[model samples]
Target: SIRLPTPISKPDRSYRVDVYDRPQLAAFMDAVKDKYDNVDQYHKLAYLRLLAFTGIRNGEARALTWSDMHLDRDEPFIDVNKTMSDNTGHGVVINPPKTKAGSRKVMIDAETANILKRWRAIQGQALMRRGLPSNVVWTNQRLSGRISSNQPREWLLAAIRGTDVPQINVHGLRHTY
Candidate 1:
């Protein structure tokens, strides 16, 4: 019988927690909002705001549809019951939550809800112009499909290019929240 060698354990294993402090978060949010003021940039603002405020996974946010949002309710909330998995051998696919807790409804603040409302209106107009139905909350500008998973990261990098705030990935925004 052959004996396998024991796995080696490192004594010093420290994980870096990348998150923005309160003031830094405020600065980042302000920078994101101010960096893009054009009519076409509304979706980006809405996406960033949702990530910063909701603490939901980036994939979950990408999976959000107009049907999952309840902005008109007395208590506005988002149903984070699904996620988009791009790792499938075939391509991007939508799937239900792996855990029961993952399918929870996250209540959002009025400000965030209002931002979404404005985005919906802008998106509705854009869809109407193209004779498309109002479905996804965020979609590719050039393409009619949903925005790619890398879009939020690209947007974050662009927004924080010259800012003093430490650079973090899109998931870090959720950690910040």
Candidate 2:
């Protein structure tokens, strides 16, 4: 093989983080609440609000079970000790946090705690209607299964479709928090 010179290193380019501001976030929340009032819609709204108010990663949030959340405690918090990882051919699996520090408890404000409470009540009723057990915090409204990982992002996209708010990925909401 012919000798080749070393490749030149590219300069680092900093990109701005895209996130919803106060007014935009308020508008987005209002839009979601006003447009979707059903139990299933409430679940989706709660999920979005949680991500917006907490900086936890998407996988961390997805991996959360009802056991991982302590909403009734004086200081409500969700333990972020694991993440939902795609195991390729084996399908999705729950795994420990990537780092020791990744496994932490994220506390929520009273408002958020109330939102979660409402969501749980609504979810419980829906599950009872379908004769399904309430195990996961985020479950498919029409079926007996966890909500798909892409569902939250899809909901966010649809909520901001015609609004003046800038479009952003679900992760951006974490940054906004």
Candidate 3:
């Protein structure tokens, strides 16, 4: 049998973005208001807020579905079912989470619950306008062939382009929460 030496741990100097202030956060979302319609705005905001609130990875958020949402129960939660990767724009597909612990339910607060409700309502209307079905929570309908996992980065960049923001990346928003 062959034995391998233990790997050394490197210092985690990577930027932890979960440090945004309320005003900055508000400004960031407000700036993107025009880039999306009511449904798209709600969807982006809901997903971003979920990332911020739950510390879930972008892949996890992208793979969420209406079936995973437990909105009726008092302790409303999102079941972390799967994660996704860029599959060359075919469509978003489900994959396992990074670890066993990553595949769990995350309970959301009332504020997030309200936002999810609003997004659900707007999403239905948006689907109706596009003549698509309402079963899928996230879709590429708005971005031609782009997946939902990539929208936050693009949308956030567009949001803060002309603003006085310090160029914090969208992934940073997850850490800030």
The prediction achieving the highest TM-score against the true structure is 1
Q: How does each model score on TM-score?
A: 0.88, 0.85, 0.72
lDDT tens digits, residue span 12-37, model 1? 42332389899988988888888865
What are the runs in model 2 whose C-alpha is more than 4 Å off? 1-17
Put down candidate 3 lDDT per residue, 35-153, tens digits, no spaces: 54365466776766677667777787777778888876798898887887877766556788878887898888887788777877887777777777645566665623325666788
Model 1 segments beyond 4 Å from truth? 1-17
lDDT of 3: 0.70
Ranking by lDDT: 1, 2, 3
Q: Residue 73 deviation, candidate 2, in Å?
A: 2.0
| Tens digits of per-residue lDDT for model 2, 43-162 | 878888899998888888888888888999999999898898667798779899988999999999888888989988888887788788767787775657667778888998787777
Model 1 poorest ten-residue lDDT run: 9-18
Q: What's the CA error at residue 46 for candidate 1, in Å?
A: 0.6
lDDT of 1 at 37: 50
lDDT of 1: 0.86
